[model samples]
Target: MIAPLVSVVVPHYEAPHDLALLLTALELQTHPLDRLEVLVADDGSRDAPEPGPRPYAVRVLRQADEGFRAAAARNLGAASARGEVLCFLDADTVPEPGYVAAVVRAVTAGADLVVGRRRHADLSATAPDALRRWFGGQGPVPREFDEPTWLREAYERTADLADAGDDAYRFVISAVLSTTRRLFEDVGGFEEAFSAYGGEDWEFAHRCWLRGAEFRHVPDAVAWHDGPDFAGRTDDAQARRSRNVEGLTLARFVPGHANRGDQLVWSHPDVVVRLDDTGAAVADVVASVRSVLTGSDAGVWLRDGAALAVLEDPRVHRGEPPASVLGRARYRVDLERPVVLTGATLADLAEVAPVRVGEHLAVRRTRDLHRGGPDPAVLQVPGVTAEPAQDVDLQRRWGHEDHQRRPRFQRSLRTPFVATERPTAAP
Candidate 1:
């Protein structure tokens, strides 16, 4: 495939020196100059940066000073981007020559969300002579520092996150990440509500996961950050406070995770248990529903008027078949009779739920259903029976004209090969 045009977005505050260095690195990227656009997103700098001569196109977007609004600045840059892909970078991070090219390679290989590796260095004390020497490829620049080991291990163990689960969003860092414009637009831009630092990336990654975007980590797309990792920063107390606030902000959006003192629901119900009138009396259906709701706080979709009358809990949501709730809810349990559920069952089902509805359907039984044969969508769950030792409502059907269709994804690990050779600097 041909290389795509990329718009690199740099979020800056009052760091002109760092911003200039990053822009210099961008000018030397190995990717085709005509295929790249540089966008500098300024977050209310007191003294705005002056435009300077650069090989590639540069556009500076400024927003009013309103606390720390990096999220809003990035959103603004994305709104004005005119490229097929958006590559995000912090103003203080300078990329290697092959950074843009490696990112392009990953995207072409079918990754909708790609995170590049960030190598940190103590550049705060470096003079202009040392910086020029490093950029000029004349001699050794500086000593490389440690990166986040947990994040690196995650990518390697999962082979660039081909088998990542819901929690994998925690490893996605926006400081050096890239994704297609269409995918970014579909998820809606970053949550501008994050006025403080941290956690704008994780929320965006979760939204992309919900939209079925492929996430990959490109280690060869190396970038050099000006300082140590966030944990190693000199200001420890402020960092901890910001992290706490950020975690709470994320708990509000992501399901199954919550901070202490929060009244919000911690474990979200994955499936909406549906009870239909299966030739049973309303009283029997209501009793079955009560049994199902023993420990689970899941909402129930009631089709029978009698069942609806008995259960008055807020969790027992009543809706018609194929309601809007079905679209939002991850799973649907259609049963003839209610089964006694322990606390563990609901929690277990939530973990193993198929990523999307209609992808996989788990049912009580799968053999000999009445009328028009068994629904191909239903997958039988063994050893689970209704209370009072009941008959299978939609059971006894398997492998006649139907067999369980397991899901398969396009999974592969990509190893990026970066060129060490550098082009001579323009005079």
Candidate 2:
């Protein structure tokens, strides 16, 4: 098969020596040089990089020195990239000859996001010539640094992310990441709001997962980071501060349990609840919104103007959720009428969603709703039931002892959605 053109984006600062070593490594890649292009995304280096002669096309894209804008620099490179797939590498990271080929293989094999294995080494004494000779089997291998135990264990536990779950985003490191140009644009690139070092990769990966992007770990696609991991280099106090900032920044975009605190209002909510005016009492609508908010880190949208006016909380929206909210939200609950549910019941329902109770529907996984392929598993909860708004007593129901009873429902049902496909460049 003809190889798809791949653009390697190297986010750089002022590490000219390391950049040259990386470029040398890229030149040695087993992938066809004609099908590969390199873009050095300089995040406002002191002296702009002037790379010497190279076989493949090489370009340098620079931005103003506005703190650590690696995220913005990467987006700039991606915007200028014309290749079918985009691979991200740090300036200090040197890829093995097979790195590009292995990463591209994963993408072409149907993985939307692929993270190459990032090994570490002390390359301070190494030069570009030595690096090239090492690839030619003429020099000794560089002394290696220990890999992060946590990361190695994570890959092992998840079987190289083949059985990844919701929290798998934590393992996606940007230094050695690759994805198709289509998926990169689909996820809106990385979060440029991140002006610091970390958190951007996690936020980007989380968004990718929310959009149903498949992730894979390419262990054979190896790269050597110039030094030890950040945790090993920094002092405890400095590390703590960085971690705190990263956690806070991540909480704004990633509503996952690890990043979010109990009370903070995040930019994206975990779940979104939408309620249309079913002509039930205003009290019933209010009760419905309350239940969802109490159940999860959720934002409610009320179609009724009266309900919106009365609901004073910022989490309550006046109409349908904006594209930003809908795009990031993990689950969406559509209520035909006001339904009363306890926090425990609402939590349980979200786990096995695409469930229907009368006119109410809850999409447990919003990506499945958008993917529009085979029907998603829609299992019913044992004690959950939605009764008509008018027939149910919204106020008194909460006080009833039997309200907590396990619900018994019928077999699962399938909901079909229209499949949408984006046009791809012909090979």
Candidate 3:
């Protein structure tokens, strides 16, 4: 196979010393210099980053200084990259000579997203020439720092993410992440609304998984972070507050168990419900939506004129779900008739969908549905039907007169929502 061109994008921000060392390390990569390029995506530093002279092509792209915009900076670099594979690194992260090759090999071998092993070390005293000798095994190794036990244990338990599940996204670290350009575009790159320091990588990884991207942890592709892991940092009131904000920001986009709470309605729901108007009564549609919302963090989209009363609830929307919602949602339910199922049952059904429940209700894994592949499994559940015609007993049947009443939904309305499109390349 022909070697794919790899664009190494380093997000930098007022870290010229770190950027210089990173560039020097890139110069010694085992990957062919002719097939590699480096793009320094500067996040509005006071002085422009100078990559200096290099054997390979190196370009610098700068975005206005506007707080922490690493996500946007990465996206800008990726958008302009002219490579088939894109590798992301932080300005402070320096890779081993074989890092680029190992990462690219995995992507070329069919991993949609690859996360390299990020080790920590005190590189503050290290210089460009010292880094070269270190790679050459001729100099004293830098003092190593403690790796986050949580991350190390996670990788060990997941067998390098070979047995990764839906929540495996938490293991991806942008400082040592790589993917094909096609997969990156398919997942809409990193979310640019992340003006904070963290959570962008996790959010991007979550969307990639939801888009059916295969994930791999490449331990051989190693890089050294400039300092210890965040977990190893000294805890303070300011650090605690920052971490709290990061957790909350991540919770809005990733509906995973660790980051989310039971009562909050996040921007991206775990399930998207599309209830078609089967000429059912307004009460019936409302009941169906309520049933779905009862057990899952779900957003329901009703066909036009289905029911305006339910719209009062923030979770209910008119018309089909937008591309952004569908892209991030794990499951999608289509109902031609009103049906009720507990949240646990709904989750179980999604795992084995496309399932028909009494001919009018269907549950599907949104990723599988988007892929347009043969259904993994077809199932049928008996006895699920539309609501009864008796309108007076609707409240009694649902056990609540205010089923449509709930707390307001809160979410960031970031612009340029990603369009739902099938991945152009196979994972």
Question: What are the lDDT scores of the predictions, listed in order?
Answer: 0.70, 0.83, 0.82
- Candidate No. with top lDDT: 2
Candidate 3, residues 1-427, lDDT tens digits: the string is 6678999999999998899899999999999999999999999999999888999999999999989999999998998999999999999999999999998888877898999999999999999999999999999899999888888899999998888877788899999999888889887899887888889999999888878888899999999999998766858886898889899888788774578877777768888888775687787667667667875688888786557755588888888888788888888887765665533356556566666554455677766765674643445345434333325356576567456567585444885556688869867
Residue pairs in candidate 2 whose N, alpha carbon or C atoms collide under 3 angstroms: 382-407, 383-406, 383-407, 384-407
Where does candidate 1 have its weakest 10-residue lDDT segment? 364-373
Q: Rank the candidate models, highest TM-score first.
A: 2, 3, 1
How close to the true structure is residue 332 of candidate 3, measured as C-alpha lDDT?
A: 80
- The number of clashing residue pairs in each candidate reads 6, 4, 0
- Given candidate 1, what's the lDDT at residue 125? 62
Candidate 3: clashing pairs of residues = none
Model 1 whole-model lDDT (C-alpha atoms): 0.70
| C-alpha TM-scores of all predictions | 0.71, 0.87, 0.87
